[model samples]
Target: MNRTAPRPSSLACDECRKKHLKCDSTTPPCTRCTNESLLCSYTPSRRGYRRRKTPWDSAKTAAAQKTPQHGGTSTSSFVLGDMDLNQSLPLKPGDTTPPAPSGSGIVPSDAAVFSAEAPTDTPQTIATNRSVELTRQEEERLVHLYYTHFHATAPILVPRKRYATQAYPAHLKAVVHFIGSHYTPAFDSNLLHDAVEVLLSPPQESTLHTTQALLLLSIAQHARAYHVNALATLSRATEMAIELQLHSRDAPVRYGGLDPLLQESVKRTWWEVYCIEGYLAAVHRQPSFRCNSVSLEALLPCEENAYRDGLEEPQSITLDQYDARFFADHSVAFSSACYRIEAIRILARVLALTAATVDGPDDIQSVDNAIVAWKLHLPDDKATAIDRCGDVDQMMLQAFAFMHTATVFLHFPRSELLLRVPTATDIECASAMVPASPTSAQHATKAIVASKELSDLAALPVNKYSPVFTCALVFGCIVQLSACSAHAHSCIVQHRDRVALMTGALKSLRRHWPVAGQALRKLNTIASGIFNPAQSKQSGTSSPTTHDSGIGMDATMGDLCWFDLFPPRNGTEDFTMFGTAHDIWPS
Candidate 1:
C-alpha cells in the first residue's frame, strides 16, 4: 500500500533547525507557536497506536501510590491518565521500580539507575594514581632542568680527559675559550651561568679522570664568579667537587691512579672550593668552617708538605709561596694561604664594623691592637705568595720587604705608614721588573734581574694568564701603600715629603707600568723620577711632579724645595732634614 508520505517536518527557527536538524510545525497561536519570528506549524500526523502501561511504569505508579516505609509522606498524588509519553517506558518484570515524580523537574534517582545496570567488575583507581605519579615525575624533571640549565649553568668542570675521544670536550674547551677571551663586565652574569652548567653536565660516558678535569674547570669558573658574589654558584661547585672526590676515593680501581694532570686539577679545585667557602662564610659574618684541614688531608699524597713542621707557627711561610699554580701541585700551600687571607680579611672587617659601631677608647684600642698583631704576622716577600714559592730565596727578600711595610701600615695611619715603609717607591722599583712600555725600548733592552723576575712572573700560570688574580694583586699592593702613605702624612709633618715621594712613585707605577716588561726599567724610571727629577727630565719623561717639592738631588735640596713650594701655613713650620749624608740619600 502506497501510503501518503508524511509531510516534511517544517523547519523551526534557523538556530534550532541548524543545531538539531529537527522540524516543528504549529499554527500561529498554536501550542507550539511563538510571536517571535519562530516557525510554528504542525503537519497532520498519523499517530501511532497507544500501548498499555509497561510493567516498569505500572510498578513505578504503584510505588508512587504506596506509602513510604520511612516516616516521610508524599505531598501530592501521581495522576493516572493517557500513558504519558515522557514516562511510560518498558522494563523487565523483576526490576525494582523508582517512584514516579509528581511534577516535572524531578531529580533522577541514581540508586534506581545503578540497580537497572549490572555492576562493573573492574576498577580504574590504580590507573588514575599511576597517571598522577607520572605527571608528578614529569614536573620534577622540568624543575631540575630549569635550575641546572636555565637559571645558571651547573658549575661542573668536566676534565679534558673525560672527553678525550669525543667532540664534546672540544666543544666545551671552545666554549671556555670564547668566555675567557670575550669576557667583559657586561657578560659576567651570562658567562658565569653557562660555565656553571657546563661543569655540572659533563658527558655521561666521560671517564672519572675526565670528569675531575671538568670539575676543575667548573671550580675555576666559580672562583671567577666569586668576584661578583655568585655565592650560590660557588657553593654548588664546592659541593660537586666534594662529591667527585668521594666518588674517586670509592672507585680507586677505576680512578685511583689518576694522571698528575688530573691530580693537579683536583687539588686546584679543592683549593678554590676551600677559598670560596671561607670567603662566603666571612662575608656572612659566620665562623668559617675549616675546609683546609680536610683539603690538606685529601691532597697530602700530591703535595710536598713543605711547612709540616712549622704548621703551628704564624706567618712562618712567606707570601711568596702563595702562587695559584702552587695550589695545583702543592695543595697545602694553597689551603693555608686561602684560610689565612680569609681570616685576615674577616678580622679586618669585623674590627672596622665594630669601631664604627662604638666610639669609645676601648673599641679603638681593641681595633688598634688587632691591626698591630696582623701586621706582625703578615708574610713578607709574599705579596703574591702563590707565584713566588719556586724561588724561595729571592722571594724571601721581597717577602721581607712586604712584611715590613705591612707591619708599619698595620699599626699607623696611611701617612705615617708611608713615612716608615715607602712601598709605593718600592712598587715603582718592582714595576721596573715588568716589560718596559713600547715608548721606552731602550729601557726594555736592559738585562736587570728584577726585570727578569717580573718577566718570569708574567709568564707564570699563577699571575701572567690570570687577569683577575693579577688585578687583585696589583690593587691590593696599591691600597696597602696608599693607606700607609696617608697615615704617615697625618702623624708626622717632617715625613710629609717622604709621603709625597711615595705617593708620586705609586702614582707613576700604576699609571705607567705594563705587565709585559721587566722590573728594572720601571724601577729606574720611578727611582730617577722620585730621587732626581732633573734626571727624569733629561730622560724626556717628566717625573710625576708633586705639589710638595720634597724630592730632589738630596734630602736637603728636596726639603728646601718643599719649603719654597709650601710655605708653613699659620703656626706650622717648614719640615727640616736631620740625618747624616747617607741617611738623606735615596736607597
Candidate 2:
C-alpha cells in the first residue's frame, strides 16, 4: 500500500471504463459508442457531436441480420418497429420463419413456437407469439365440445343456458380455455393465468363464476398433471363455496340476487366442486373435504333442462336419509350426472381411509359395505355391469367406471393383489395377520370381472368422453395384469391381450396427460420384463426395485406399482380425512 501510486485509466466514459477498455477521446461519439449505439460523452473541456439514426436504420439492421441472403437481390424492405416487417427479397423454398399475418397480433421473439419441448407444432402453440382473441365460432366449438363431451360427466354449468346468455363472465371464459386446452397439444399457462385472475377477482353478482372457474382450473391442472396446483386451486374453490353457503340446503338460489335458475346453477356448481375435491383426493391418495357431514344437506342437482326451465325441485332429505333415497331413485327423474357425483363422493371416502391403511380394518369394511350396498341398489336396467344394457350415455358409463374402480381400490393390498399395485400402502401392515380371513381367489374374482367390463369400455371408440375412463382402465388393468403376473403359468386369460389393453389405453390417455404417459412407459418396462425376462435381463432394462409404499417384492416378479396416496407421515402432521372414519359418510 505504501509504494503504489494508482495507474491512470485510458478509458474516459463510464461504459468504456466499466468494460476496462482503452478509449479514444474523440470530439464526436467514440468508436465503441458509434458502433454500439450507446451514449458517448467527453471530458468537460470539449463538446461532442453524435450522428442520429432513424428508426428505419434499426429496422434495416435487424432485418439484414435476421434474413438470409441466398442471392444478391433487392426486395421491398419496411420498418418493423411501427408495423409488421416486410422484405421484398424472394425467400427460398425452405425458409423456416414465415412472415406475420396482418392483424395477427404476433410479435417477433427469440422463442420458437416449435421448440425442443415440442418438436412439432400444436394448435395451442400455433399462435404462441400472438395475442389470442377467440372468435365467436371458435368459442362456440369449444363450448359445444365441452357440453357434448364434458357436461354429461361434470354437469357443473348449465351449458345451454349459459351459452344463450349475452353477459359472459370470466369463469365461463376460463372454462372455454380449459376445455380448448385439452384438445390443444401444446398448452399455454398464460391462458390459465387469465382464468385464475378472473376467478380470484371479487364477486359482483350471484353467478357462481368464481366457483365454476376454480373447478375448471382444477380440472385443467389435473388433466395437464399439475396435481399439487390443482389441489390448491380446488381448495380455494371449496372455501369459496363454503363461504357462499352453496352447500347448505337453506341458501337462496340467486341469479343477481334471487333467481331460482341461478339457485339451481349454484347448487350444481357446489356439488361439482365437492365431487372434484373427492376425485382429487382419491387419485392422489390424500384426505379430502368430508361431505358426509358439515350440515351440507343440499339435495343433489336436477336435470339440466329441468333446472333451466325451473320445472323441477328435488325433495329435501336429511343427511342420514340421503343415501337410501339417493340410491333408490333409479327412475328417469334422477339426474344421472348427480348420481355420478355421489358415486365419486363414495369413492373419495374409500380412498381417504383405505388408500394408505392409516386407519384400521373396521374403516375399510364400513366403506366396503357402503360400496357393496351401492352396487346392489343400482338399477339393473341402468347398467349394474358394463354390458347390462345397450346404448348407455357417457355420464352413466362414467358412473359405472367410478363404481367399479372404487371396488378394486377398496380391496387392493387388503386381499392379495396379483398385479401392479400402486405404491401407497404400508406393506408391513399389509402383510400383518388380521382377524378377517384373507379373500380366496374366487372372492378376488369380483375385481377380475369388473376389470373385464373396463376392458370392454376401453375398446369403445368414444371411450374418451367418459371422465372416469382412465381411472377405471388403470385400476382394472392393474388387477388383470397383477393376476396374470402372479399366476403367469396358471392364468387362463390371454396375457398378451391384457397387456395390450393396458398399454394401449394408457397410451391413448398419455396424449392428453403426462402422468398417463409416465405410467405407460413404466407399464411397458414392466410388461417387457414379465413377458420376456431373459431378454429384459440381457438388455439391462432398469425396473424400480423399491416400492414407494414400502411394500417389498421378489426380483423375479419384475416391477409392481403403488401410487403414493399418503404424504410422508412426518411431512403433514395436522392432516386428517376429516374426523373419525365413523363420521366420514352416512350409512
Candidate 3:
C-alpha cells in the first residue's frame, strides 16, 4: 500500500482531532495516521467562509432589523398608559355587541376611530376595555385586597405609581377582583367564573399584563373546580413566556433592553409558569412540560423590593446556586419569592422525572440532597412559626410545607400503582410485615415523616401552595393511619396524634380549598372504620363486617358514601388524573 508523507499545516488532521492528541500540523497524514492507515484531513483555511448563526442569533438580528413601531421607538418603550383610547371596548364573553364604553366613553372623534378599528366587537376587544366598573375607592380596596393577599407570592401585577394615568386592561382588573374576592366573603363562586370568562375570550398577543392576568385567572379557575380551563389557560401563559424567550439566559439583556424591572417581572412570570405547570402536572398525574432545571437558562427571581425599587443593576443567581445557599440563607442574598421559585423548581424536577418513571436512585438521591441542604441552611428567623399569620409569613410557612410535600410525593407510590401490584400482605396489615426491602421501608418512613411535617404546617392559614400541600399532607396522614392500623400493637404511641393530625390538616385544608372538603369526608368514613372496630372489622378493608351482634331491624341505618377501594373500573380516569372535579378525589 502507498503511504502519503505528512505535510505541515496550521490545523490538526482529522485522525489527530478524533484521538484528542497534539497535532504536528500534518496536512497529508501525520506519522500515527500513516502508520495506522487512517484517513487524515485538515479543515481548510476559511478566509471567505462565514460561521453559521444560531437560531437565537438570527432572532436577535431580525429583531434589530425591524423598524420601530408607533414612531421611532421600540415596542418596550410603550407603557400600558400610552395605549390609544380608540382601542378601548369592554365586550363580555360571547357578546357580539360592541362592548360597553370603558371608563369614560371615548370622545366622539376617538369613538369614530374605534368604530373604524372594528365595526363589530369581538372577545379580544372586550379584554382590552378600560371601563372602570368600580369607583376609585372601591378599585383601591380591591387592589389592596389583591396586594395584601396575592401580590407577594404571585407578584405578576405591576406596582401602583402615584399620579400615573395608565388605563389598566379590563381583564387584568377583573382577574384581580376575582382573585382578591376569593379570600373575602364579598365574592361568590360566580364572581370567580366570571372573572375567568373575561380572559377566556381570547389571548391577546401575550403581553406582560395579559400573561399575568391569565395566570391568576388560571389559578382561580383551578380553585373553582374548572380544571380543564385551568390547564388550557396555563398552556397559553407558558406559550407567551416562551414566545418572549423568558427561558433564555440572555432574556434580561434581550427582553429587558430598556426596562430592567420589566425584565425581572418577565423572569418571575416565566418561573411562576414553571412552578404552576409542575404542580398542575402532579395534580393531573401527567407528564410535565419541559421547563426543568437544565432547560431553564433564566435566573431565579431576585427579591421583591429589588424589582419594585427598579434597582439599576439587579443581581441574580442560578437555581442551582440559590438551592446551594441563596434560598436557604437569608443574609440579604435571597427573598421569599426566590425560595418559593426554587422549591417549585425542585418539585417540578422530582415530579417530572417520577411521573415519567425515569427517576432512579441517583435522581432520588439528588432530590434528597437538595432538600437536606435546604433544611441544613434554613434561616432561624424564617422558620415555620405557629403564630405567624401575615401573608408573607404564611407564604414562608407554605414554602416549607411544599418542600415536605414534594418529598412525600417523590417517595410515595401512587394508590393505583400499589393497588395493581396486589401484595400478598394486605394493605390494612402493611405494618405487620417487613417491606420487600430496607429501602422501601425507608421511603415509607420518610414519606410518613414529611406528611406529619406538612400536617403541622397546615395548622396556619392556607397559602396559594396550600392546595398541593393539602393533597400531599392528607395522603401522608392516611398512610400513617394505615401503618398504625397494620401494627396496632406496636405503633400505639403516636396513633392518636396521627389521627388528630390527619383530621386537623383535612379540616384546615377544607376551609380554603374545596378539594380538601371531599378528602375530609372520605377520611371521616375511613376513620369511622378504624376507630370503631366494635361496629366494623379491625382491618379497615372495604369488606363488610361480620355483624357478630346481629343487629335488629329496629335500628336505623345511616347513609355511608363508600370510597371505592378498587381502582377505576375503566382506564378513562386513574390515579394520574384522580383529583379533578369530575373524577372526585380517589383513595
Candidate 4:
C-alpha cells in the first residue's frame, strides 16, 4: 500500500493545533502525522478572537443605562412610558385576536412614544402608561428587580439591558409586572395582575412573546395560591410552546433570523416550560407533562454567563451528548441550566414511576439508573453547587434538589422509610413478607441521606432561588419528620432538627410565596401527627414513635391535594411576611 507522501504546508495540522504540538507544516501528511497515519491538515488561523464589543451606539445606550442602584444592579434604558396607543389588543389563551402592540418599546406605539426612567429598584416609582394600570417607572423597577433576582436564577426573560430597552406586548409586560412586583415592596401585584388580565383580548395568534408570558404567569399563579390556575396556564404555555415548535431540534431556525440572544431565549423558554411543568405535575400530583418528552430533541441551553453576554454557542451539546459523556472519554462542561433541565426531566419520570398503573420492575430500575447517572456525570465545577466566588449556584442547587427529591419519591414506598402522617405523596405500600421489589436497606439509607442533603439546600436564603422550591422542602421534611418519629435514639433528634430547618425555610419563603405558606401549614400538621413536641410532651401522652405505627400509611387514599392538606389560611395575613405590602424588604 502506498501512503500519501508528506507535503509542506504553512501551518500546523488540525490535530496538532488542538494538542499544541509542533507540526512539520505539511499537506497530505506531516512527518509525524505520516509516521502515525494521522489526518494532517490545516486551514484558517484562530487568532484575534476577542470579547464581542458592544457597538458605539449600543455602548452609549448601555452606558446611559448602567447607572447603579441598591444591591448593585444597573438600571436598563427601556423607554416604556410613551408606547403608541395603536390598536394594542391582548390575546387570551385559545382565543382569536391579533395582539397588543408588538415592538421593542425603545421606539413604540401608535398613540404614544412612552419612555420611562431606566429600570431601578430603589423604592422609586415613575409615571406613564395607557392600558395596564402600572406606571412606566414602577414597571421599570419591577422588571429590573425580576431580572436582578429571578432572571439571574431562572433566566427565561431577555437580558436586563435588552428587557429595559426592548420587550413585547402590554399583556406580556403585565405578566412580568405580576411576578416582578412580588419582589418590589412599593407595588401591589394583585391589582397589577387584575389590570394586566383585563387587557386580554380573545386569544388569536401564538407568538413567542405570548408563549413566554404564559410561562411566567403559570408559576406566578401557583405562587398566588392558584395551583389549578397554574396548571391551566401551564397547559396553555405547553401547547403554545409546541405550536411554536419550541420542542423541535430546529425550533430556533424556524424563526426568521433571530439574533443570538433571541435564539438563546427560544431554547431557554422551551426548557423553562418543561421544567416548570414538571414542578406543576409534582405540585398537582398529575401525570408527567408531554413537553418533557417533546423537548428531548432540542439542544440544551449554553452556559449561563454566555447567555448573559449574548454569545451563542456555535454547536451546542445535545441531551444524547450529556447522557453518553459518562462512558465516553471526553466530557462536556454543561451549563447549570442544562443540568437543571435534566434534573427536572428525571424528576418527572420519578413521579410518573411512583404513579405508575402497571406493576413493572423495569421502570423503577431504569429511573433509578438515570438518577444515579445524573450525579456521577456531574462535572467538577457543578459537583459542589458553589462557584469560585463562593456564591451559591441557585440553578445548580435546584437541579440537585430535583435529583434528591427524585430519590426520595422513587424509594419512599419500597425503602421502608417511615412516614409520620399521610404526606402529599401517596405511597402504595408493599407487603412486609413478600415485597415485589425487595426493599433494599440501601434504598432506606438513600432516603434519609437525601433528606439531610435537602435540608442543607433549604439552608440557602430564600431570595437566592425560586419560590418553586417550596415543594422540595416539604418533600424533604416529610422524610426527616418520619425518621424523627421512627427513632427516639439520640441520633433521631438530629433528623428532628432538620425537620425544623426545612419548615423554617418554607416559612421564610412563605413571606412572598403563597405556595410555601400552604406547605408550611401542611408541614406543621404532619409534624403534629409525627411527634409534635408541643402537643406530645405537654399532653404527656405521646403517639407511637416507632416503625410499626409510623410506616402504616393508608395506601387507598391515593395522593393528597398536596397544597390543600390544610384548609384556606382564613384570610389571615402573616405579619412576619408583611409589615405593609409596600414596605421594602432586603434584596
Candidate 5:
C-alpha cells in the first residue's frame, strides 16, 4: 500500500510552526530564516514548555480551554502564562485543562503555544486603543472639572468645613498653577474678580493654614489685575498678610522647605499692597481716603532699635539711605509693589489730563517739575538690590514723567498750542539755557516745550478738557495717528517749531501715552457726552480765544497742538482713549 509518508516532525519555533514553515531547531529563532519564510526553529520542549508534573497544571490548562466566565473566548492562558506547571499559578479549585489542538491531536508544548488564543483582536492592540481612549476621556474630565469648579457661578459657595478642609487649597493650587504655568492676556476678567471676592470674604475660625495661604495668593493676583478696584483688593490683602504673619508666629513652621520663590511672591504681594495704598492716598483729593503719615511710615520698614555708643543717635539720612538700608532689605517685595502703585498713579494722572480737569498752567508746570526731579533719581541699570529700591526708583521717575505730561494736557487744549509755534528767537533763547548734562538738557527742553504748548491749548474753547471732549480728542488722535503715519509725521513737523521752543516737552508727552490710556478710559466714563463735539453745541465759537498778556491764543494753540502729533496703531482700534467719556458728561 502506497501510504503518504508520515510528515516529518518539524522542530520549528511555535511562531514558525503556526506559519507552516520548516524547522531549523536553533536555540533562538534565526532572523534570516524567519524573514525568508523558513522555520525559525527552537527545541520546543526546552523553550517555554516544561513537563507538567502537578495536578494544578493540568487543571489550569483545562480551565484556560473552557469558555471564559466573562462570556468570551478563552484568553486567560495567554495572560496568566503556564503558571500551573511552574508551581506559581494562583489558581482556584476545579480548574479545567485547555483542549489539545485539533487534527494532530497532539497537545502543543507551551513553547509551541506562541500566543494565547487571540479574541478576534490582539490584547496589545486592544490595550493600546483602550489607553488612547482613556487619555482622551481623562482630558475631557479635567476640562469639565476646571469649568465646574471655577467658572460655573459668579460666587461659588462651599460649606465652611469643606472650603477650609479641601476646596480652598485645591482651588488656590489650581489658580496658582494656572497663573504660574498658563498665564495669558485673554483669560476671563470675571475669573479674577470672583477669585478676589472669595479670597477677601471672611474666613471661618476653622479655616486651614493652607486655605489661608491660598486665599492670600488669590488676593495678590486679584490686586495685580490693574483694574479700577485693584487697589481696594490689595489693601484688604495687606491686612490679611499682617494677620498671616501673626498667625505664623504661633503656628509651627511646617512647609517641607523654605521656597525662595514662594517667599518672594508673598513679599511682592505685600509690597504691592503698600504701594497702592500709598499712591492712592497721595493722589486722591478726599482727605478721609488719603493715606496718612502713619500709613506711609508703616509702608517703610520699622527702624531697627539697636543701641549705639553712649548716646542714642538719630542717624542722618538721605532718601537713598532710607531706600538702600531700610527699604533695601525688602527691596524685591517693596519695589514690585511700588511699581504697581506708581503705574496706577501715572495712569490716574493721565486720565485726569485726558478729561481736561487740570486747573491751570501752574498745575501742569508743578507736575512737570516733579517728573524731572523723579527722573533725575532713577537708576540706569537693572535693579538687583535686595530691597530692589532701584526698580521702585525707576517706576517713581516714570510715573512722575507720565503725570507731568498728563497734567499739561489736562490743563490745556490742542489747537491753541499749535498756533503758538515758537519764534526763531524763542528757540535760540531756550537752547542757550540748556543744562550741562546731555540727558538733562534733552529732557528739560522736551518738558518746557510740551508745557508751553499745553498751556497755550488750555486758553482755547476748542481745547477745553471736559472729560467727554478729551476722550474723543485723544481717541481721534490715536485713530488718526494709527491709520496714517504720513498724517502723524505732518502733524509733528507742523508743530516742530513750538515743540523745539518748549524744551523737553515732546519727549515727556510721548512717554506718557502708555500711562495715559488708563486715565483716559476713566475720564471717558466721567464725561461721555462731551467727547462727541458733534453731539454738543459749540461753547461759544470754534475760533481760538486770546488770553491774558502772558498767554496768547497762539500759546493756547501750542498747548492743544501736542494732541495732533501722533497717529494710532493698527491693533489699537479697539482702544478708545476715552472709554469712560459717557460717565462725566452732564445728564
Candidate 6:
C-alpha cells in the first residue's frame, strides 16, 4: 500500500492546528473543516514562505567537531533556545504569526545541524529536521503512544492536558518529543536521538523539569544502545536531582508548595532515579545504590490512577514503612513503581550476594529467599501481570521480570548445565562462578524455573516492555538458550520451542527499541556457536550459508532473527543436526 503525498501547507489553519488535524492550508475553509461543516481560520498564513535550509559546509563541520574547553568562547555545543522550542508549541486561534523554526541545532557525527554562520542562541530549526518531518496528527499519535506504551512503566510525565497548555522548557520538550518519536514511523530514530542529545548537552538552569528531562532522556539513550552516553547522562540527572534535594522527604515543601500533580511528579522522579540507578548498576554487575535508605528518605510514588487523574494521595509510604506495613494491610494498594523500587532493592541484594565470596549455601539462598518472600507478599491484584483494565500491566510485568532475573543471577552460576564457554563480563551469569555447595542442584532447578517464567512473560502480547524489563528478558533468555544446549538431547528438543517465546519477544521488541537489537545480535553470535556444529568444527573458515540455505529457512526471515533454532528432523537424522538460525548481526 502506497501512502499519498501530503498536500502542501503554507501554514496549518488555526482550527486544524488547534485540533491537531492535518490541513491542506487551502483558501477559506480547509478540507477537514469543510467536510465536517466546521469553521476554519488561517490568520498566520505566509503564502510565499519557504523554509530555509542550513548548509553543511566545511566551516560548520569544523565548528561542530571542536572539543569542549572550559571558559572558552568557542565550543561545538550550543543550547537550542526557547524560540526553537516554541516551534513545537501548538498554534493558537486568531494568532497573527506562527512561530518560525530556529536557524541552528547542534550537529552529531552522523548528521549536520546548521552552518557556522548561525550565531549561538539563535534558536536552531526545531520545526523540522533533515530526517524528522512529522505533521500535527503524527505528533499527537506519538504522544498518545508514549502514555499508552511506555509511560505506565515509568509514569513520570503527565498527559497532554498539561503539555498542550503549559509552555514547557526546551529540554523537557525535547525529551518528550524523542520518546514519542520512538513510536512514530514518520521519523528516523537516529536523527531524533541526535537532536535530543544536542538539546540536553548545553548547561541549562537546574530545575525540577530539567532533572526530569535528563532522567527520561537517559532511559531513551539506554534503550537505543548508547550505553556510555546513557550512563553519563543518567549521572548528570542524578547529580541534578541530588542538587535539588529531591531525595529529601521535605524537598517539596522545602523548595515550594508545589501543586498536588506536580508534587507527585517530583516524588516519582526521585524514586525513578533510585530504581534506575540500582537496576543499571546491578545489570552491569556494579554494586552501587546511591539513593538507597542510607542517604535518601524519599516517599514512594502515588497510585498511577490517582496521579493520572490529578487526585491527592491519601497516604504515602517510605521505604521503611513499606517493608513493615505493606504486607500486613491488604487494603494498602501499592503502585507498580513502588513494587519496581522493591524489585531493584532485591536486585541490589543479588548484586551484593554475587559480589561477595560465597563460602556457604546461605549466601545465595538468602537472596533467593528474599525474592520468594517478595513474590508471595504481592497483592492479589498484582499477583499476576494483569491490570484491572484486563490488559497486560507492563510495569507489573517488569517488576516480575526483574524479580525473576534476580533469581537467575542468584542461581545461574550453580545451575551447572554444562556450558564451558565464558559469557561476556557484563553478563553476570556464568561469567564468573560462585563457590559450590551440595545445594547446587537446587540452584540449577531454580534457574530453570526462573527462565521458564521469563519465557511466559515474554509470551504476553505486546510490542515492548519497560527498558529495564527488556534487559531482564535478555538476561533471562540467555539462561534459557544455554539450557537448550544441555547434555541430554531429549531435553534440548523439549526446550527448543520455549526458546522461541523469548526470541520472538526480542524480535518484536527490537522493532521498537535498539537495546533489544544489541542483545539479539550478541545472542545470535552465541547461538551460532551453540547450534552450528559444522561451523564449530571448522574454527577459522568462511561463514556457511546459514542466511538463506538453512533447511527450514524462508525468505521472510528478518536479519538478526535467529529464532528458528531448529527445523523438523526425521528419525534417522540426529537432533544435533537441527542447525543454527539465520543472520543476527549486520554483515
The models' CA-based lDDT, in order, is 0.30, 0.50, 0.52, 0.59, 0.29, 0.58
lDDT of 2 by residue, 1-587 (tens): 58885543333664464453556645457778788998876422111111133665456555555543211222112121222101111111111222222222111222122221232233322211222344445556666666655665566665565554423343455465556556554555445443333233222123356567767766765555444445545665666566667777765343323445555665677777776666655655454454433566666666544654554444343344545565454443455565577688778766566535365657767877777776665665544423334544555667777777777766654444522342223343322322144553543566677677677767665435433355566667667655654454546246558667766877887665555665566556655655555667577753443332222223433233242322222222333322211111101
If candidate 4 were superposed on the true structure by all CA atoms, what would the RMSD be?
20.5
Find the candidate with the highest lDDT and give its number. 4
Give the winner by TM-score: 4
Total clashes for model 6: 5
For model 3, the stretches where C-alpha displacement exceeds 4 angstroms are 1-133, 160-167, 250-261, 305-313, 323-332, 355-363, 379-395, 414-435, 463-468, 489-513, 532-582, 585-587
Prediction 3 global C-alpha lDDT: 0.52
> Between candidates 3 and 4, which one is better according to lDDT?
4
**How displaced is residue 550 in candidate 1, in Å?**
12
Which order, best to worst by lDDT? 4, 6, 3, 2, 1, 5
**Prediction 1 global C-alpha lDDT:** 0.30
Task: Please identify model 6 stretches exceeding 4 Å from their true place.
Answer: 1-141, 254-258, 326-331, 357-360, 418-435, 528-587
TM-score of each model, in listed order: 0.30, 0.62, 0.62, 0.68, 0.31, 0.67
Superposed Cα deviation of residue 278, candidate 4 (Å):
1.9
Candidate 5 residue 558 Cα shift, in angstroms, is: 23
Candidate 1, 410-493: lDDT as tens digits: 222212222222332423232322222232222112211112233233323221132212222222222232232233345334
Candidate order by TM-score, decreasing, is 4, 6, 3, 2, 5, 1
Question: Which parts of model 4 are misplaced by more than 4 Å?
Answer: 1-132, 200-204, 256-258, 293-295, 312-315, 418-437, 528-587
Least lDDT summed over 10 consecutive residues: which range in candidate 3?
Answer: 104-113
Please give the range of 10 consecutive residues that has the lowest summed lDDT in model 4: 578-587
Query: What is the model-wide C-alpha lDDT for candidate 6?
Result: 0.58
lDDT of 3 by residue, 1-587 (tens): 99997643346665565444656765687777888898876643212101233454345445544644211222321111221222223343222222222221111111111221452244344433322234445456667777765676566555545112223444566677666665666545453444336334442555656666777776665655555556556666666666666788877656445556656766777777777766666555444454453377788776666566665775677767764564443454566666666666677666555544333677678888887666766666555533234443534565676677677666655222232122212334333222344476666667667766766665555544435455555555555544543343445457547667767766765655666677677666555554554454433343332232221111111222111221121223233211232334421
